[model samples]
Target: MSGEPEVHEEFEARLKTYEGRPAAETGVGRDPVNEPMIRHWCEAMGDTNPAYTGPDAIAPPTMLQAWTMAGLTGRPERAAAYDELLRLLDESGHHAVVATDCEQEYLRPLRPGDAITFDSVIESVSERKTTKLGTGYFVTTRTDVRAGGELAGTHRFRILKYAPARRPRPAPARRPGQPGERRPRPVVNRDNAGFWEGVTRHELLIQRCTDCHTLRFPWLPGCNSCGSAQWDTVAASGEGTVCSYVVMHYPPFPAFDPPYAVGLIELAEGVRIVSNVVGVPYDKVRIGMPVRLEFRRYDEELVLPVFRRYDEELVLPVFEGVPE
Candidate 1:
């Protein structure tokens, strides 16, 4: 594939129309606090608080004016970023790009009489990769919602763009008569016990801080998000991109081999985690590779998500400016 990005006119047209625009100014938008929208939000969140449904319903902190907006389809411009990424991947032939992680922050609650505007930007893009099947790209979009000109919320959306494999690369081969590297067993704690158990089931788990309502990782006894002692374990989608990573040249553990890549992956569940990356050669690994969660079974009750190099077969001209 060429290094030059093949800009789709249809995608650009949609982006130009939606960028820096207000929904109200465009018409055909719903009021966030309107009865129907509010009820829908309440039901969607399974929140039964009278404050939201009562005559004097105080809007929930999680509510945003953008929540009232309906999903789009007819408007080719709607989801312009996602469509653009998909088109890029399809053109390249890596089709396995998938949603892995998202992080949202509620700046303020949606209230009656608030007119909201939404603006989105293509925050970042990653280098093209050669996966087993084809080439792929990882794209991130940041969408901001403003109520009455004040920041109401922010959504960080990520997608994988894949295309058919043009130059199929061989998968990593295990050394003959050599066992795979081993990772030390981690002792379960009260806070992380559930998380470890979930991993065995090939599921990701995060602790929700009751006090601050923030999601905490690494399974702390107290809420790392809010310092609250009360917490709950929530299941997470075991998909994410490599937020940061490193290839260790030195062997500190007997079970680990030299030149293995360790990465901190940002999951779609809004949590970041550290794990080993496999399935691709060490030299090809880079930040933001579009990886699917693969569970490695250890013994009877242990499983963990190990990232494999994605899109290892499609060929693309070398790209610059992506995270290493």
Candidate 2:
């Protein structure tokens, strides 16, 4: 409202000029459709379907845009009109860019030896809108892909060019004895309701398959090993060893202290569970340290199993017989 009205009007007029204009046309793919690229794509996606391999291979439909990429040198087919539109946005302080989403439609399969080509047009430009990232415009472009002179796919991509908004820093974590702060609530569904119920009663329960005798934690309805739905609970021996651990330090949250140790505890029953390793400094927590399970009440309603390491004095004697 404070700036010159004529200048603002000129900017809007320039942006509208790009709509329905060619962003890129008569663009030829740098490489022909081949099996090697398809194999690499399938391997990276963990897609092992037989149709994507061997003599009958067809490139994955999602690779429609990959064929038309400009690479590091950029596309010569791009029109100067698209570049001018972006330059105008940058001049208006909307410099940052992030791709929002994309939609694709495949009409025919792309097979080996098929040459690829494409044409793209500026689809639409949205009115200025305010978002968490800041105020910006949404620009959309639609590309039509052709293979062997036939329509193969259509891809629509949208991006937001914005001036980023500043976010306030997160609140500091509350101290151990502070009031008005609680741990994040656990997600309890029917599949794991029994496990949470067991915790409320100061019991650590593991599910055991009734048919195959295999035990699993984080309770599930069916046994993954045998696909059996029959199962029962077993009380743990309350003994375990620290098999692995990690220290969290970033993106501090109000509910958790930074630089705390979370460990994967291998229980004596041959199953593993994750819990906070207490009774020792976070930095001192090591793999294979013997620990015993105990219940801790964070507040009146929450009680969880935590592992406590044996006192350092008690563990030192066991290592005294060996050389340092």
Candidate 3:
């Protein structure tokens, strides 16, 4: 998803305040995922294990990844805000951003009934040298997933926000049914160009780390899990549910006006990605909503993979039962 320059500037300003504040400690809150959520995730991933759906449910290992990133539960709390300098750094327009890389370490298993809290901090921020177009910064946020005040897991998210090639236009008036600008696009390069190329084809491709046999998205030369350098490209089914989402209004991208919805979509193959929900109103794009892949052309070599809603009104499981 993208944001306008002004709103981008404002966000950067606020982030600066968060820089030295120390990752805001989150209080114990109710489990964001309830029974329905659990069922949806299990079904979305085609995971029918009794443990996840049974009365005594043990959460899936990846469930904590979703739970912690949902941000603080209940009302908006300042406990997680970043410093001012960081905020200013975020002002540059960016879209359809992905976590090009991430590292998560699980210390304990999470059961369905466990009440967990994620105490997250802005781990670090580093600037990238300017290439042909514009420049950007990489921000890493580390969150400690805690269950009943005990350590359960730790997540390190590396996100890149870059300046847009074209300047954004003025944001339009709010409309009830539309989506605004999207988030920043993950930085693409020669090594991972094939992955982005797949997006242009409306296909999801993962690089299987040849040495470790791990499926890697957003393309990486070395395995984030095992540090293996060999990798092979494989096609994936571009289908999954909304793991989480955000409705951006403050900063609108020129390509998209206010307000649009950007989501953390977990693909059927188990790779979680960031994109927008199309062919449906933003208000209706709820968590757990099923979506299918669609290709978007951004210039010549660049194609973006976005999602469109699938429901009774629109058939879901679009890629399911289809031949591989």
Which candidate number maximizes lDDT?
A: 2
When sorted by TM-score, best at the front, the candidate numbers are: 2, 3, 1
Q: Write the per-residue lDDT of candidate 2 for residues 20-65, one digit (tens) a residue.
A: 9988889899888988888888899998888878888888888888
Task: Please give the clash total of every predicted structure, in order.
Answer: 18, 0, 35
Stretches of candidate 3 above 4 Å error? Answer: 1-21, 27-33, 69-75, 78-86, 92-97, 129-134, 166-324
Writing each residue's lDDT as its tens digit, candidate 3 over 1-324 gives 244678646655544445545454674444544677678788899998887766777777777667754354443322535534344555444332335457888898776557777677776665342433345666777778888778988888877665543334444773322343233456878887788777666668888888778887667678998997878877877678898988765444444554567889988877788887666666567999988888865443445788877676655543321111
Model 2 weakest lDDT span, ten residues long: 315-324
Clashes of 1: 18
TM-score per candidate, chains pooled:
0.39, 0.49, 0.41
Superior candidate under TM-score, 2 versus 3: 2
How many angstroms is residue 196 displaced in model 1 relative to the true structure, after the best TM-score fit?
1.2
Lowest lDDT sum, 10 consecutive residues, model 3, at 315-324
